[model samples]
Target: MKQYTIGKKAAVIVLHQLCMILMVTGVFATGYAFRHDAHENIDIYTLISLAGLVGSFVSLAYMANVAGRKSEDDYTIYYLPIDKVYSDVMLVIFTLLMVFMGKVISGVKNQHFDYASLIMTAGTFTFLFDMAFIILYQSIVRKIKGNILCTHSLMYKGYELLKRVIEKKDIHTQKTKEIMRIQEALEAISEGALDTTLNVNEFHGQQKKVAEAVNHIRQGLMSSVNESLKNEKLKADLITNVSHDIKTPLTSIVNYVDLLKRENLENENAKYYIHVLEEKSQRLKQLTEDLVETSKITSGNVKLNMQKLDLVELLYQTGGEFNERFESRNLTIVTKIPSEQIFIYADGRQLYRSIENLYTNAAKYALENTRVYVELEKADTKAVFTIKNVSKNELDIVSNGNVDLTERFVRGERSRTTEGSGLGLSIAKNLTHLMGGKFEIKVDGDLFIATITYNII
Candidate 1:
């Protein structure tokens, strides 16, 4: 079916009205001719009238069947023979036919001035009204909302406005729907949707191009993420292997160094060298073990054993081990813990380690003769342990400065004069979180603070 433009429809309306008028004139003229003589020979006027009747019927059928109806390319089951646009046109045509029929009947029966003239006059007025009605119908089509096929199919009144506009699809319409589908897929992917695939087969031209591009990007992203994860796993495995390899040989060296110390050899320099060697080897072993443990905590490889314990007692116990070292650094430990026991549910080993890290960190770099404040108290539903001290080195603390320190190998001391592998805080923080505790650290100039909060039992 050809597409109907406004100009084409207007042409159709004009032709239909002219056909109707001619048909009515012919009908009246033929009726009068036959009425005058029943057996008159066939004349040119009668032949001309017959042709007009045939042409009128053909014109009526053409417009009634095809005009304003959708050209559906897909299979559909339409229960109604006539669609909305044609139905209204048929109603108007029927009403006009009845009006013309009545007037023609009157003119035929009346002994009026000229019957042919009266019939033509009746048709002239009818065709005028017919043309006006068709124009009004075209005006109606202009007011339908965007996307008529989706909205106007409820068998309601005034749906004729969208009757001619509705179609299964056109080239532009198919392209629009495909473009929308592509956009929907893009949104889903951006929000981390993984399972759904776009229907590239349904699209054409640029829509298909867009869908394929998105699919390719998604594949690339998944590949990149997987590759990154694989590389991280290999790095973690390498750290574990290196730690184990160094520890095995280091254990023998430490044992031999201690054995040599037990010998009563009067060689002072050899004994001192053995002591230094033992100390340096032990430090190296501790650093390697810390690296491996940090990896395990981060990767969730360590199993936890949760139990109820007094948080205040645990803090005092951790502080005790670091007391001699704290005094050596000229730092005094000050406790502000509640006298009442505050119990919490946590993995004892990991919790103790987290606390030890904070105390050791303070003791190692706290300003000499300054107090390292260790405070434990109840805040809402949590038992909070806070450690604050004045840092020895000139510190540059900004927003996120202390938070970033929890990353492995990030240390406050640039040259690492103090004995630490920099994995202490990272392991402590990760293990704290794994055991359902919150660890936070803050640094303001020389003041360094670490707070660990656990849910009270």
Candidate 2:
């Protein structure tokens, strides 16, 4: 299809050139045949030639228009310095030739051979042919290099240089403004202002693209955060409802299990089974209570009774309570307490529970015959409490190397063979936070460390 179109255009251009040549030839022939007194009486041959000349000239004009339209469609003609120079030179040559031809025609005698007129006519025809050749040559050059012709133009280069020189400062100022705006938007996002949006229309080019991209990121973050919050709320609500519903049935089961244990049983197997049922029912009741507590803490529905409490006394009490459990596993307890009392403002019940959870974690996971270190010290205006223990199993296998221990239901034992609901660390961490304290857990090889810090009062 493309080849056919090219062939059609080539045929049209050829016809146009032929018409131009014919028109030029006709003009030249009439000028050559003219005599000084030819205007007095017109011959039949002259009349026929004149009519042909007018018809050909009309055809040439029409073809020139067609060629011009084709050129305009394919190539853009820029009037550059070179074009101006070429036009001026052509005008000078044509003017000189026309003056010389006029002088020659005026000097010719009437009814003679008219040699001067013939020479002038030939010269005019040659000039017209030269003009046509130059036009064709320029058209080819413009077609090949049309796109880059402006860049190559001296006038265009000068204009560009001048424009840059005049607008350099303005460009720098605009760029600085765009950078500051982008930084401001990023800072706002970092500070949890997801509602902030960048105006893309105020920027141009690459800056505009950057602004649009930032706005998209901000919107995406807003959506993600909202979805996460909604899901968290839903999870909390589900846990709360389920725990409440289970409590009623669990109370009846506990009461019945207790009643069965009290009644005398003749079958030894039945008595053993009833004992097992009582233990399992108690475990289930404790698990339900933990779930309810966790839901309340996570949903920010729990209250704290903040008061001044001694960190040293809390640590001692927690250690004493866990002494028997640690001894059962052949784990030794080492205490590092400062002599001076360090008091912190926090909820006493919550703080004790947080410390108790740490002790429980150490007793459950610590290696047998290993020493567990418990410390309470005052540092500057803060009271720090820490517990470190060596695990019986590989820390990597227990928590998969990097799983957060404080996440709900995340336990150190992968097989979950240990007696725990896996909510101890989570409850502890949330309780510490509620009492305006910091909680962190670190695992290194077989070593596990849990630290809690609060502002001293």
Candidate 3:
């Protein structure tokens, strides 16, 4: 079963219950003072103080409950009239009953029913005020069904203010700037906004401004993402056209070279030249295929057939495939596998390619004879796959310093000098995302680590 910590929520609930009691007591005191004669010197102001204290406490409870509800419940359910409001209404009724009793007591004490009508009126007024708020909230959103949800929904008023700025704007220019500012403020607030308290008027004003700013920023980001997608399509098309043009002639050239060798051009000098040409041609073909596949992945045209697979087995198979390649560079693959089958959901082929890229990348750029460490583990309901390799040079890509360090083809300053198309990590990153996981690369000194995590439970 899903569960939530009852620490703060339980506290608020207790506070709310206490406030309800105080509110009822305050109502009775106020009514008693109203029914009393002016000459009695009954010190009616004392009742007023109790009422003030009760109202203040209740208001705090309401605010805290609202904040708690918003955190745990869906925004759409926030406007729903829940049991908490009904419970509050019930308390108001109890307050009215107590006030009526207080009136009778005061009347008996003062030996007069002269202020009876006034006491009843005061009781009626307090009851109506509490009931009206309870009824009015029902006309909006419903909150989630749980103690936690009820508490957070109390902040719906603040959320609604922000929602308005985003949806009900007229002038795009003013609205856009406001939305941007709101987003900035929200970012700051998320960083520490709740800790800093402010009055309703000041807080709501700031909230509206932040909401407007956020709306503008959201629209702008969406537009930018669309443009980036279009540009990627264009890049893919260019690569496609270029590949066709280059491969057609190369295919014929290779066929003609074979024919030449068949015609006794296999002499020492002729064979040496032919071998060089064949190697260069094969290298170009391999590079072209990599470019095409990488482009397809980037343009979001490739689909992966995913399934549940054993993580340790997959890693072992991938390492074996690259063993011959890495052996030439004196690179070693050191793996630390637990004696248990770690299962994960992913496309086996894509996962293989991703890991292969990491190993090959290490072989190409890592220091000779260095071991590339591969480890698998299950922690916190996630399957973690980590690959660590040596870095020969400093990485030089600056993607606005996002710090996740997995933004596509970013290589170390030293690795950039090696022969690579720089699309290996980018493809791996996208593949991880498609597989419902995260891919992250971190650089520490001479070591570069690629980590992938997927939820297994």
The best candidate by TM-score is 2
What digit string (tens of lDDT, one per residue) describes model 2 on residues 286-349? 8899999999999999888988888888888888989899999999999999987888999888
C-alpha TM-score for every candidate: 0.55, 0.58, 0.50
Reference-based lDDT, each prediction: 0.73, 0.74, 0.64
lDDT (Cα, tens digit) per residue for candidate 3, span 15-35: 544444445544555445666
**Model 2 segments more than 4 A misplaced:** 1-172, 199-209, 328-330, 393-399
Q: What stretches of model 3 exceed 4 Å from their correct place? A: 1-225, 254-272, 392-418
**Candidate number that wins on TM-score, 1 or 2:** 2
* Steric collisions counted per model: 0, 0, 28
Question: Which 10-residue window in model 2 sums to the lowest lDDT?
Answer: 63-72
lDDT for position 333 in model 2: 92
Report residue 245 deviation for candidate 3 (angstroms): 3.2
Candidate 1 Cα misplacement greater than 4 A, ranges: 1-214, 340-343, 396-403
Candidate 3 local Cα displacement, residue 35, angstroms: 40
Q: Write the per-residue lDDT of candidate 1 for residues 234-336, one digit (tens) a residue.
A: 8888898888888888898889888988898888998889889888888887898898897787566999999999988887788888889988988888999
The candidate that achieves the highest lDDT relative to the unseen native structure:
2
